[model samples]
Target chain A: MENKMGYNASFAEEVFRNVDSGDEIKMCMNCGVCAASCPLREHMDYPPRQIFSLIRAGKREEVLGSQSIMLCTSCYTCVVKCPRSIPVMDVMHGLAHYALKKGYTPRIEAARFGKEFWNQVYRRGRVDERDLAQRAYFAGGFWEGVKKILEFADVGIKLVLHRRMKLIPEKKIKGISTLRKMLDKAEMLDKGRSVQ
Target chain B: MADVQTTNQSILVVGGGMSGITSALEAAEAGYDVVLVEKNPYLGGRVAQLYQYFPKLCPPNCGLEINFRRMRQNSKIRFFTMAEVANISGSEGNYNVTIKLSPRYVNDKCTCCGKCSDACEAEIDNTFNFGMDKIKAAYLPHEFAFPMRYVIDPSIVETEDGKKCQEVCEYGAIELDMAESTFDLNVGAVVWAAGWNPYEAEKIDYYGFGEYPNVITNVMMERMASPNGPTQGKILRPSDGKEVKNIAFIQCAGSRDENHLPYCSGICCLASMKQATYVRERHPDCDISIFFIDIRALDRLEDFYTKVQEDEKIQFIKSKIANISEDEATGNLLLEGENTRTGEQLRMTFDMAVLATGMVPNKIDIAGAPEVAADEYGFVINDPEKAGIYGAGCVRRPTDVASSVADATSSAFKAIQSIARR
Candidate 1:
């Protein structure tokens, strides 16, 4: 009797009503192809297939709170192989966007990197790998940052050896003012549309 | 001439497999003259090659035996083995069919004697066993051959062993001079039961069906399990005849994806489940694992899935096998895929692996037989203009034995109805 809590449509309905392309998951057949094809599936609490299942089951807290939605690498393998062509990658990105919009902090490693990467890209035209890594490493407080920097030092040294990382910070791209204006305008439009 | 031909109310059922046999019997027993044509020198199509069928693990031969009996009892049914519909022309009620009969070389005059096969030294691949075994140059298709006749391979017609086979046969059943013949028949309707062929596993390439000896198909597994098959009912690896204790079944080998067959071949899931029985029955301690994206055991058939699942030995891994490579040292197959449930990247070894390859309509090879139109996958779709021609069983869509039988029976009624109108 306890297992008879059948799928609740309200959560899925609420998602469809609010979030963009959230209803695209209605095409999911739970074939597990998406999850199997996903390279980062091991790090996910719920694979793409199970995420859809949870969505159907009206496990709102579990679906939004899961770190799985934030783990998509956008490889498009699942999108290519899905029998139903569910646009699984898009749904994952959409879920992550909606989760952040709902003020639910994912606090996963990927989200941390993603936030740092986004902030750098928004401030400058592009990101400097050294500065981005520094910000990401130190975001966990001083001792943890020191440990993280030490852990990644080998790869950092390799990059420096290969000349992939410059000694100083990267300079701003040409037409920074124009780029900032466009970004601000796009952001204003995006926020206004989402609010509506 | 056309007016006289239009008066014939006979129906021709192509491909003497389950659908064709059922269609012929249903139409013939209902008092319409029926012609059952087969490409091979046998009546039972793919069903006869199977060790057992689904839902009920009954021997496929028993049902085929009874069908042949019913066919023998019915005088209205006239069947030709080693026959093909070379061409079909004219409209719904007045179709002129040209049939080409390939010489079996060995005539039906003699009894089922082993002398011809014994004397023949040349060997040929026995397709009935899915090339798992070899047959003598002169051989019966299988022990359960309906006509109980032998066929001489055309390749060895002028060879020394072929002459020796002809010389040794006491009854002069071997006819080396037998030339192929073509004949025509007038029929009111045609049942395109020209069934399906297994999607070639070599085309999948990654599974290495042709490259790796231990990698076989589900059909080959069925033949291996058959009591009269290559290994005589023993589940052994084709490479070295070692007992298969641990085996893997890869489902959806070429189906339900855009890369290969784009449609979900309905029977592969259940078919693989039944194939697992072959391994389990052979070795009680055999470890059976099936890698699949989804198990589509539908309706009441879920009972069989449940029964097999509850066996405690058969494990279902939720993943589509990504690739297969040979463990060159041991000659075992290494199956690689991520277990979606546990998120485990599996690189498992097995004594044997059976790919549940999908079914492709046989019409792909034999196209342009007038009035027969095919889908992209070569499944013959119903031609409304040529209303007399109806696609039965797998020709119309992917079907299981039960569905194919039901389709054959219903298609029989459709043919009869068309002829009655004529």
Candidate 2:
């Protein structure tokens, strides 16, 4: 955690120019309403409002490495309740994405799960629930994955019985190629500039 | 009263608040004919509702009394209560104004005797107290109300209880049949001193203002502390009438926020500090916390901020309260937020919470009125070249009482200048 108190705007400027909707943080008055409104605030090491405060104070490593960035469920309560009308959810998700790209794995499990989820959508036009769940469970390693799957054995059985998960192998949708082309274009655009 | 003589050299001052009264009095004292109109049944406006002013902490009545006395003695100033400018036409030195007058129900013969209210059984929300209590349908606006007259609620005019009130009036002041009327005025200049309305606290859902009984706005707190207030000057929790041992003053409730009043209200910080004294005066040991993003004491008022800072019981938290939730068991409030200075999350409970809500400018929407442009936030803009039309006081911008008086004086001077040019 970079605790140097003197304001260094270099990192803030970088985040503003590079992070998606990062410029919106400039409007924050540090009112703490976003943090209070956040349902996941208690679980966060640095709540949404505090994260913005840290960002402005030039705590670049602390902000990027904080697990709070990856915990956004995107319920959008902060965005709607923000008096400044800041896109708080977008900023958090943007920071999370930016952190991963910068090689800071704050929450490795969350990053792995996200990568797998994205891969599923890219490979198959739609996510195969059963296949995605197994892939996510196994990401930590085979033995630990088995233990985690065992912990959710009843949920898995219930899912299969409810017909929410198919026993057969998943099939790619008819328009998989078109979807892949659109995703590729999105990636290309993302690489060129931040997409709100 | 209908034949209020006015001409091309006369000034028409809209609103009867401190600003309007000052504008009218200043112009009239300068020997210019001035006509003052107020939508309320009496003058004083929002200032009348305040328990006391900041810095000096003197009662608003003292200032209001002087203005009322000046208004009463000024022969050049003709004033009307329960009146509004319905329309304005022409320009500069030749403006024709149509004034809408709502019936007072009780005529000038009113002795302000409490008999009518005594005989009246019909009750209505006492807006003077921000509807914190109920009053007889026929009652005075307040004890210090100018004109010292009684007004009858239109809802009870045709009811039997209203008839009883009319019969009990020995002075024959009750005129239940009084009808709404309109009249015309010719003026050289128009000064819109239409004051401000308290920003709707209920709109900020996170504060739980309307949802929580103990949570009230700063304006309501003024009334709560006033001798003539709903609780008769008792600072008691609304739910159980228990004296508050701990109170929270949440500053900038709806001010300085993009979703609310984006402009800083300029007075709320000092107002909250002044109110903290009200709590400490009643209960010396009472705990008071003022939550604010920043303390905008500004200019000379910084001394008052220092004085408040000296009080150990009154703590100033450098954080905007995130939200407030009520403890249904005790009707106490739990305020949630982070102390921005320490980066520590806070969840403190208080006996009551006062939301330092900001002021919203009253809408100047008179049909046929001269073009007076307002800023994006609806504060009337002062255009130097907009002929004789002028905006003053809170209507033009959020200001303290002293600043409002000064702004109103300037408007009066401008109005006189416009008339002199004519």
Candidate 3:
């Protein structure tokens, strides 16, 4: 490996100011408890501990491009086990949201799934499982979408028989517009929080 | 004589560990009258339990033996084992102290013969070995227990087992009805050398100290390596008594963390490194890996770190082990962590694991003495202006044997100065 350049403070300063609970990473002594306790650590390209180290080392691209931040299942094991009591789960979620706002889709599948989930709630004020499933499965293309739908055809039949899904197009909930306004307001506030 | 009449000039040393021994001997050798009180029946507190010291790997008894000899020949020193300071009053020059002495149940007339232990039926956990084994109720503290006498367990003193031990004593050493007593001594200054207790490893929970048969603390590891340990000089797994071929030493088990001991115990890094050699020497093929946040072998001890680092079989991994689990069937331990230096996720198995736990200073409550301060972590803070009481050794900070001796010598000198100034 080549000799790394000296630590740059600008990226860390940005993370501290904009990312939620990002300032708490300053307390990390690199003990690796966060990574060890993370249930999703094996799937992550970089573990939570290394993510924090990258943030400190000013590897902006490596940190924002890491799938580790988006892979958090919010298990809370890292949060509970951290010797420094760092809010690890919150920070990981915060990073995932931040990456999307910065136009960095580190993992497109997770980003697309999150967007579909949000769109379903915003449009109907409640999720229509059939429609949400269709959107998610078809996001790849026609053939891939058909393959996924066929793979889950049995489960879909089981849901309709169980009355969990309705064949008729469901109407919007009673207060759909009010819920959308509240969500929009919340999004505006979240955007303002990062700017300040 | 043109001298102001000050009250008592004798000094009182309140613990009989390495520090207390040094303080007592240094003052007594300087011709100042000294009284040393210890809570245990024997004088050597924690060091006597060590297999060997660090750096040179010299046996602790080498230094302890010299101090014991100096203590024995010095006529100015008077000592009491199984005693505590109940109360202290007055100022720097003339302080009245009440010493509470617990009954050993065996007096000076009884020589250490094996007859009492042979006859005694009651058995208790041998704490000297961290309860890894048991000893007869009527037993000596250890093989080289000072005062060279036996101690009848107070639990047995009331039962029929007590009568058997009493009757078996050909020397009339067992005193079944010995009562607790208190006495008063006026001393010019007091040296509070009350040492330390190992941080409770079980409290960490994730390390599975009490839950796993193969996980042991650093202090317990020292006893395990000793010739007189429960295994009799053999480093064997506690669950199966099998010889260990691989070991993992988890450093900073309870130190340098906000949840546990927040300060770095100055000696644990070196102590663990020293213990690594203990395993390597006995089982030359034993693979040892020490996982640590930092190898804090500061000062001259850094050279020892360099030497240990040079060993091909001993790996110095820079990571604090996150947790440990036991493989129940084989009685092996699984250590989990990510090696920070390499970013490699580690889930390694070993025959046994030693948790490098830190020290907790034994609380000192000197009633009616000057207001003694302690830091947030409960280490005693000695006020230089108040000359009556001095906190030395681990009571003041976590330190090794050599530093404790040096600190004790300074306490001894300050104690003499307090009297002379008076």
Pick the DockQ winner.
Answer: 2
Give the alpha carbon lDDT tens digit for every residue of B1-422 in model 2.
Answer: 47888899999999999999999999999999999999999899999999998778999999999989998898999999999888889988899999999988899899988898999888999999999999999899999999899999999899998899999999999998899999999999999998999999999888898899999999999999999999988899989999999999999999998888889998999999999999999888799999998899999999999999999999998878887888888898899887778877888999999999998998679766668778989988777778698888999888899999999999999999998897
| lDDT per residue as tens, model 2, A1-196 | 3346677677888889889999999999887878877889889999988889788888889999999999999999899878799999999999999999999999998888888999999998778888887888899899978998899999989989999989887889998888888898899888896555
| Candidate of highest TM-score | 2
| Each model's total of backbone clashes | 0, 0, 0
1 against 3, candidate with superior DockQ:
3
The full ranking of all candidates by TM-score, starting with the best, is 2, 3, 1
Model 2 lDDT vs. the true structure?
Answer: 0.90
What docking class should model 3 receive?
medium
Residue B240 local lDDT, model 2: 92
State the TM-score for model 1.
0.82
- Write model 3 residue lDDT over B179-275, tens digit each, in one string: 9988888889989999999999988988999999899999999999999989987889999999999999989989988888889998999999999
lDDT of 1 by residue, B147-230 (tens): 999889998998998899889999988899998888789898889888888998897776898999999998898888888989
DockQ of predicted model 2: 0.69
Q: What is residue B220's positional error in candidate 3, in angstroms?
A: 1.1
| TM, every model | 0.82, 0.96, 0.91
- Fnat per predicted structure, each in turn: 0.22, 0.69, 0.71
For candidate 3, the share of real interface contacts preserved is: 0.71
